[model samples]
Target chain A: MTEDELGGRLAATAEAAVQRLAAALGAAPLAGETARPARLLAAMRHGVLGGGKRLRPALVVETARLFGRDIDDGHGDILLAAAALECVHCYSLVHDDLPAMDDDDIRRGQPTVHRAFDEATAILAGDALLTLAFDLLADPAGEPDAAIRIRLVTRLARAAGMGGMVGGQMLDLAAEGRFDAPAAPMGEAEVRSLQAMKTGALLRFAVDAGAMLGRASGADAAWLARYGDLVGLAFQLADDLLDATADAATVGKATGKDAGRGKATLVALHGVEAARRRLDDLVAEAEAVLQPFGERADALVAIARFIAARPS
Target chain B: MTEDELGGRLAATAEAAVQRLAAALGAAPLAGETARPARLLAAMRHGVLGGGKRLRPALVVETARLFGRDIDDGHGDILLAAAALECVHCYSLVHDDLPAMDDDDIRRGQPTVHRAFDEATAILAGDALLTLAFDLLADPAGEPDAAIRIRLVTRLARAAGMGGMVGGQMLDLAAEGRFDAPAAPMGEAEVRSLQAMKTGALLRFAVDAGAMLGRASGADAAWLARYGDLVGLAFQLADDLLDATADAATVGKATGKDAGRGKATLVALHGVEAARRRLDDLVAEAEAVLQPFGERADALVAIARFIAARPS
Candidate 1:
């Protein structure tokens, strides 16, 4: 099949999986008495189902496929894992947009949660979503292996917590306004570390978690993990490039916004041409890691290329 | 043993267990090239071990004893679980003391985390601790049963999330200044619900998690859960009463402070006499739940009574 056709097919599969996963998560009894706080549930659903490229879920499903596991056989566990990651991502977005954090008024082409609801409710909603991520992963109905499931939880926790996302955020906060100065300009090494942690960790987690569920072991698991890390870094560079080059409408959120705020970004530190070259290098390195898997690795290879080329 | 003597012994056991658990958690991996962040690690250790009654760990031990399991056999998992709960509790205190929340400066006779660190670090520290709680429980070396471990994770998440602690905080915030109004003082039922969720959930999780780890099932597990819930509420009421009558030095933290803030507390709504009476009723109920387990349940029962009558 042509690359576009393959991409289309993968996209359709991912969409179907996401729908199934969302339904399963929604059916969970742990949401508590539905009648008492209907609005909270509504807000949760809205945030979870809101528009964005379900790239993380796609990575999970594709990686599982690469491991010779039929997505349909263990689809429930895969979806639950995807759902958990999405919940964390959504919660981060909600909190990031809060007045205390990034203070953005828009997200995913809609009014932010604090704008849609009150600030306190929005904060609580974010907190609820975060806890729910752990709840969904820990549910007994999905992923019966205790050790593997625990690994998944640990992976996501590390990705979302201080050493990963939060630490990167601290660095970003510290790097503001210092990017343009003659003294430093946020060295390439520092920028890479920041992006790898802040954005790449979760993406890598998506792929690695799916592989774990599929029981990939020994060298295969290590290979997939390395692939994930490389692609995760590439994904962030692509995002930085898009943020610098794309318009707000095209990105469906806000674009060129980071530059306006003096945030350290690949395109900001290194010019667009240099950033694009670095993206090419990263993508090539990611594809090289997948070479041993041959045809089974095609989807991941294509994904890296697409991530680099996508408009948003 | 007399109640005081029994209580003292259990308290000593808990202190020893806490020390052991901290040491186990502190042992760094020999292979890693870089050391973990010392300050962050210290903050986490301080937040967890800085001193509370260690009531949760005690309950875990006592519940395991009632199940005919030796504390030493499952001590590692129990301590990890207790440490996890304490982390959650400490994080809540740190965030709750922020200027936006309770704005308290003193906690456990020391400056609260936000006062000690910057507001941003305090926020991240709390977030880290919250995430670390799940990470600790999901450790493969500790709890081997994935399904049961998942259940423990889900239980803690629900209890600590919006429907539990955060929900209680919202209700308390909404009810501020209205506790003394003519229309119906914060009713007994509301206070019970708030305390049950805010404090009782974690305590209940502590006992039940220990029971689960010990492989207790059927009626024993159910009874332990009941015992835990009652004691958790009694503990909250005792805290409220102490806040109403104890000196700051005696409580080891600010006392009589909630009333000044117009926060709706059990003692503020119910007369001190009524609150004390309720505590007595709760202690009796808790002891009755433990009766079927015979003398093995003695430590837990005594702890419950002590929680209601402790000087601080």
Candidate 2:
């Protein structure tokens, strides 16, 4: 698949995710026998429906497609997984942009959820979104097999909970020298560990969740996890590189926050040149992980390259 | 059972929940490959381990025992479910005490999580606890049956999420007249709906979840759910009445917050005397719901009366 073809596929996948999410959310009763509060729904839509590349869902769908014999019919399970993953991603973004956390006013070129709604609503919106992710996974209509749904819940919760995303956020917050006791200056290994937990965990889960949905086992699951890890690392490196280099208009959120906050990131610990080299190496490592699947993994390889090459 | 026996039983149940919760939370890995952050764990412990009646867990244990053949050995499933529910309850207390929400400094005669820790940690602790609730339910060893675990997740998620606890909270917040656009005074029906969603939903789920863990059938589940509904209402009404009449020393938290905040509550709407009358009626309704179980439900009947009569 050429770059243009991958771009089109990515766009189409993102569109489908957005539509499914909107429909699913629309159909959701916010309260039992009561309409979902319009304001809360609006705040959730603002956080979620706002434009992004939808890279996480794309990875999920693409990974599932690798194992799917009939890709068309298999999309239901994959889409559900993808949508659930995106909910977590969006919730993280919403919470990460809170006044108490990252304090960012803009996300994806729009006001942050807290700024759009009130702080309490933003907090609740993020909470609701996170809860909804598990709800979506555990839905009988999503994954027919109870065992599969349970695995999804366990894995997704691990990835999104304290051990993964929330823990990473705490580490990141501590690194910012913001709390009563500023964390000691972090080294390269520490930064990597922080990034791995804070950012890489969910990205890794995205691919692994897709594989689970695909019913991939043994070597297939291991290879996809490896692919996800490398790509997740690469994605963060690319993001740090963007933070260091990209303009706010191009990146859609404030840039250079790492340097400004004195937060320890690989791009800060290692210079831009070294970080860029490492990102390239990771993309290569990611590609190598998929080599066993041959041409069937072309899109995933394209994804890895896209991670390395995307401007913002 | 006599009142004194019921008090001893409730105290024992509360103690078991506390011990189990401490162990479960201690075993929790705040992050993968890292000791759960000492401070975060401390904050979580501060929030959860603080003394409370632990009435929710008692309800879970008693409800589960209503169906258990060997009540002695069957505590594992019920305890897991109980611990998970308490986590949610504790998490709600932590967040609800935040400056952005209720802004209370004291809870159960101790500093609130945000008061003891920073706002950010309190938020994350609540988030972690909420996530941990689902994690506990999804544990392979907990229920063994994926279908059972999935049902637990589904029901708990609904009870805790926007349509249930969170949505009810939003309604309560809106009723507080704190927002720029203050909501009009809620009627008794609206207050009932809000209370049902906010406080009653989780309480309803507590009994229902206990029944699920006990493998109750259709009619049994329905009866327990109805019992939970009536008892949950009684619980909240009793709480409100306590808020109205009890001193800070007795209630442990600040009293008269509702009147001071102009919070729309049934106690405020119906006045103290009427609220007490309604509490008795609810306790009666709750007892009536358990009539089919006859003498086997003696403990539950005792529970309903205990709920109505317990001093702060």
Candidate 3:
């Protein structure tokens, strides 16, 4: 497909997923017993209802489709799973943008949660979003198999939890030189590992979780995970390139942040030419991993290429 | 039993639970796939291992004992669950103390996480602890039943998530009066709901979760839940009184924070005398709910009274 067509398809999928998620959040009862407080709900809606790419949710939906289902089939179940992942992604962004963290003021062309509302509300919104992610995963209405639900929760928790994204964040902060004692200059391996955990882990979970939900057995699950890892690496490389090259307006958020903060990235370590070369190879590897599924993996292949090719 | 003897028993239970929890935190592998970063783990340990009453863990242990399993039996399972709940509690405290929130510098007589570490570390620590709580819940080694594990995840997520603790926090902030436009003063019912969700929800979960672990059923589970609600109220009312009346040294943290923040509380609405009287009634109701369990519930009865009587 042409790149524009591919972009259109991805946008369409993300739009549909966001609609379902918005509805779910709007109707979600507090404590599963009563209506959520209106003000709190508004804060949550402010954080989530504001538009973004919804790439994580699209990944989930597309990955689930690989196991002999289409977007039209099991739409509710697939969208719910996608929405849960999206919640985690959005929560991470909210927390990352806090004055204590990256301190960014804008996201997806809108004011950050802490900026639009307040820091306290931003923190709670992130907390609630993260909590709601798991709640949505364990939701019986979407998936009836208790075992699968448990596994999904376990994987998502691991990916989002201390050992994964949160741990990576700590490492990232340390890498950004502090005033009192600057961080030791990091090598390529360290940067790769940090990115793997901080950004790649959840992306990996998106596909791995899809495999679990699809009941992909040992071999099939392994292939998806491999694909996920390669795509994750490629996505980050592209992001690094964007940060190195794109403007804040094109990226829809701050760019040149890594270099400004003295944070290392593969692109920073190996120049833009090398980074682009590696990203292309990673995309090819990602596509090859889907060879076993043949034509059924077309959407995912498109997604991998899109990750590498997106301008911002 | 004499009040002093009762205090001794509660202290002993809390101490044991804390030790087990500390050990578990030390040994926990992130995501069961990798070691957590040393610095991040230290931050998490700091937040969790810092001393507190451990009343929630005690509640879990004591309530489970009523259903036929003592702390010594299924000790790993019980401690893990209690630790999970405590993690959530500690995480909330860490976040609540952020400069953007309550802005406290000390907790449990030590520097708060942000003060001890930094805002980034504190924020990440809270996120990690919250994530670890769910990780502990879905632990296959502890609760082998997938159905039960999923249920545990669902219940805990609900209690800790938007509708419960997080939602309550938002209400608490609103009650504290908005910076741009102060909130209308909360009435008694508003204050009650805020307290119920903020503190009571998790306390209720501690007992209700114990019943889940013990496989309590029908009327047994209902009684435990009702008992939990009463004790949760009693615990909060007592806490409000202590906040209004205690000193920082006695409370092990800042007191008079409620009044300072303009945060509404039961004691704030109804003077200390009325609040104390209601607490007594709550304790009585909590004990009365345990009547059918007979002497098997002695520890729980003691717990109810302790909730009303603790000085700090």
Candidate 4:
């Protein structure tokens, strides 16, 4: 598929995710034993709905689609998986934005959840969103097989929990010398390990979950997993590049904070030009692996190219 | 069984939960892509291992044992379920003690996770602990049937998520006039609803998970759920009574603050004498529901009685 052919397809997938997420949040079953849309639910909806690229869900759906999973029928079970993954992503943001964490006042150009609703509510909302992700996964309507569903639950829990995003966040803070006085400057390897846990794991799961849900086993699964790893690295590299070059307005959040905080990212260790070249290499390696799958993986390849050449 | 016969069984149950929880957190699978334990893991251990009666896990193991579940073989998978539920319980306490939430300086006679570590680490530890709950439930070895495991996951998510514990917490905050001015005076029913969500839900899940995990379907499951509901009410009422009458040292945390904050409880709505009566009634109802099981349920009945007569 050409760029023109893939036009609006990504956006369309994003839109589908947004719609499903909105429906899920809007009609959420629990109001803490009440039937009305309580303040907690409203805060959750606020944290989740509105903006962002919906990139994670796109990875899930597009990868599932590549494996011949039918999403035409109410998006099959893929949308639920997609939405559940997005919940983890969004919950991370909500917690990360707390006054105690990143202390950001705005997300997607709107007031953060804590700012809109108080700190306690934001904390509870983040907790609820995280719990909701598991709830969605365990829903009987999602995966056809209980065993597969449990596997998905375990993968997501690992990715979002210890050794994954939360653990990565702690490492990131430690690198910032939060616990020690002027912690030793981190090198590239440490930075890569940190990044792999902080963001790479979830992005990896996006593709891994899709392939697994589609029952792509053995070599087919191994190849997809490889593709996920490359894409995860490429996506984060591009994000760092955007942070280096793009304005806060363009990226829809603060920019250039890495250098400001003296944090060691690959971009900080190596120049922006080197990061760009590395990104190119990543995209090439990512695309090369999909050659075995022919045009069925065109969407996945397009997503890889898109990641390498983001909004900047 | 006589109280003399029951002897240290409750203490033994509590001890079992603590040991299992220690192993789970000590040997946590993900230190975020690292094989060694990380700061996040340490903080999680700090939050979960050092304190509390492990009542939730006891409720799980005892209930399952009543249905012939075994512990002689390393506590069986019921211990995993027990450990998993305790994680949720621990996570809530960690988050609740945050400066932005309850501003608690200590938990179980020691500094809270935030005071012991930094706020960020405490938050991350709590997140990991919560995620670990599902990880335990979804573990292939936890339950023989994948279908049964998924059901356990779903039930836990609901009990802990919105319209349950988190939602109940929001209501409690709102009742404190955090979001709205005065928020109208809460009556007995309103207080009951708030208490149910804030504490009752998880207490309910403890027995519900045990019964389901033990394959006690049909009428057996229904009776256990009813018993869970009554026990949940009894536990909270007893807690409220303690807050009203006991000193901080006995409970290992602040007491009388519930009324100081003007937080309404059944104990506050009706005087201490009335609350005690209510506790008695709840325990009776709880034990009555288990009449079908006869002597096998003596442990459960004793537990309900113990809940009504906490540290007081």
Root-mean-square deviation of every model: 5.3, 3.5, 3.5, 3.5
lDDT tens readout by residue for model 3, B12-55:
87777677667766775655244477777788888998888888
Please tell me which predicted candidate would have the highest lDDT against the true structure: 4
Report how far residue B281 has shifted in candidate 3, in Å: 1.3
For model 4, state the Cα shift of residue B265 in Å.
1.7
Native contact recovery (fnat) for each candidate is: 0.33, 0.47, 0.66, 0.65
lDDT by residue (tens digit), candidate 1, A224-264: 88888888777888887777666544673343555454456
Instruction: Residues B1-312, candidate 2: write the lDDT tens digits.
Output: 898888898899888888877986677463233335566678888989899988888888888778872224733455777888999999988988888888999999998988887888888888878887887788765666789889889888888887788878887888777667857767788888788878888888888877887788999999898999998788888877877776445673444555555566787787788988888888888878888888878888998888887786
Ranking the candidates on DockQ from highest down gives 3, 4, 2, 1
Q: How displaced is residue A291 in candidate 3, in Å?
A: 0.6
Q: Point out the higher-scoring one by DockQ: 1 or 3.
A: 3
For the predicted complex of model 3, DockQ is: 0.62
Q: Top DockQ: which candidate number?
A: 3
Model 4 lDDT per residue over B150-230, tens place: 988988888888878887888888877777566666888888877778888898899988897778978898899888889
In CAPRI terms, model 2 is classed as: medium
Per-residue error at B63 for model 1, in Å? 1.8
**In model 1, which regions exceed 4 Å deviation?**
A1-43, A68-76, A177-186, A243-271, B1-46, B68-77, B177-190, B242-271
lDDT of 3 by residue, A1-312 (tens): 566776787898888778867886777575433336677677778788798777788788778778865455743376777888888888888999999899999988989989988899899999998888888888886666888888888788888877788888888888886424677768998888888889888999999877776778899999999999998899889988887776445673343556566687887788889998999899889988999999888888988998888877
DockQ values for all predictions? 0.32, 0.50, 0.62, 0.56
Instruction: Kindly give the stretch of ten consecutive residues in candidate 1 chain A with the minimal lDDT sum.
Output: A29-38
Tens digit of per-residue lDDT, candidate 4, span A205-299: 99988897788978887888889889989988998887777644566334345544547878878978899999999999989998998899999
